[model samples]
Target: MEHTGPDAHPWLVALEQSGLGVAMRQSLLLYPAVEILHIFGFVLLVGSIVGFDLRMLGLAARLPVAPFARHAVPLAMLGFCLAAPMGLLLFATEATSIAANTAFRFKLTCIAIGLLNAAAFHLGPWRSLLQRGEVTMAAKLGAVVSLLAWSGAIIGGRLIAYL
Candidate 1:
């Protein structure tokens, strides 16, 4: 692996040279398996989150948000659990190029934004949602942000291969 410019950093070099990274690159089936797992994770995470967000946005006004959130949030958390470590492993395989990739950076930024939005919502509006018996403007805004952030992350992830 040729390292140059930003990709020449020691940690990136070391990551790409690690046993996990080497194994990922050497075994075609392993890489594909990991990729499939990663895809499954995102599907669960994003799909559940989107469903919750739509509810917050008043898609199914008749359905109580609290119960929906209770069910969906756990799935989102589980998805994150599966995706995060797999993502790190995938990154290890081509740390240098992946680190330098514009799409990768965008995806990371979007993920950070999405996480922060979730945190803010849970800490703020979410606590009152049950008692309030209605979605607050803050919750709606958070839902919109969540939708856009996760969607952008997905778009950026897909573009990573091309760009």
Candidate 2:
């Protein structure tokens, strides 16, 4: 995707034309590294969360489900943190292109939905479930929703670039 519109995305234009942007663009050396790191972050995020969620669903681990849910949060957060800024920088490079793209908007909406879903889980049933000291059908349902939300977010994210 490329930039467009007469207004010329003031933010992106400033970034791309700035010293940092010029330096970033000029460096053929760093782009590949950043891209690879971003992809690695994606793998880590999906792998950690999905693996943890699946384990919580008892689809993988023989042990109890709670630990996976508890322990894997940080790893997933790390991946998300890694990807978020790079994704922003990448988007800033071509904001006008994305502004004209529905799929991009859809992807962001999905991510927001997923995040909100997660917040709901934490603020509601999952909190009580954990405090009660055992996972239940409701907890399992929550896990399933988590898995679906995250999967949706990932699929939508990938679809953004494609569209």
Candidate 3:
């Protein structure tokens, strides 16, 4: 089905018509390259976050949390820098269809939740916990939630093809 009509978001429609988007959709090799980059980016992003979460859950109690965050957070941000633009390009390829997709919506929601959980951790208990060099129950809980949310987003992203 073709995307048209007032129901479709104007920005999405414009994106779908953009030169980059057209190339992404029409060029077989370019599409696959973008997909590969997207996968690699998310792998980096999720892997870094999971490692930090594991630490917060007491898997590496001997390691200091602040130093670890210094490394992990930057890696995660780097992954995001790689993944996000690729993801947006992929979406532009089939904007209207993806916008209407249940899995896509769920994935976005999960990402939002995951980001909020991270923000809550950083703004609240994390500040104090980092200073004192102790892991608190709240930190552990946030870690668990981060794991779940990011995992759900991955699952949802994968399911986008099938569902």
Q: Judging by TM-score, tell me the better candidate of 2 and 3.
A: 3
Clash count (model 2, backbone only)? 0
* Tens-digit lDDT track of model 3 for 1-163: 4465779988888888889879997897999999999999999899999999999999978998898999999999898889889999899888877887899999999899999999999998699797887888899999999999999999999998887
Q: Highest TM-score: give the candidate number.
A: 1
Which portions of model 1 show Cα errors greater than 4 Å? 1-7
CA lDDT, candidate 1, residue 62: 97
The best candidate by lDDT is: 1
lDDT (tens digit, per residue) of candidate 1 on 7-107: 37999989989999999999979988988889899889999999999999989999988889889999999998888888888999999888888999999
Query: Which is the winner by lDDT between candidate 1 and candidate 3?
Result: 1
Per-model C-alpha RMSD:
1.3, 2.6, 1.4
User: Model 2, range 1-163, lDDT digits (tens) per residue?
Assistant: 4564576667756666566555556688766666677777877777787776666577765665567666677788888899777776666555667655677777677667667766776787677767885566665776787677767767776777778
Best of the two (2, 3) by lDDT: 3
RMSD of 1: 1.3
Name the runs in model 3 displaced over 4 angstroms: 1-6
TM-score of every candidate relative to the true structure: 0.96, 0.79, 0.93
TM-score, cand. 2? 0.79
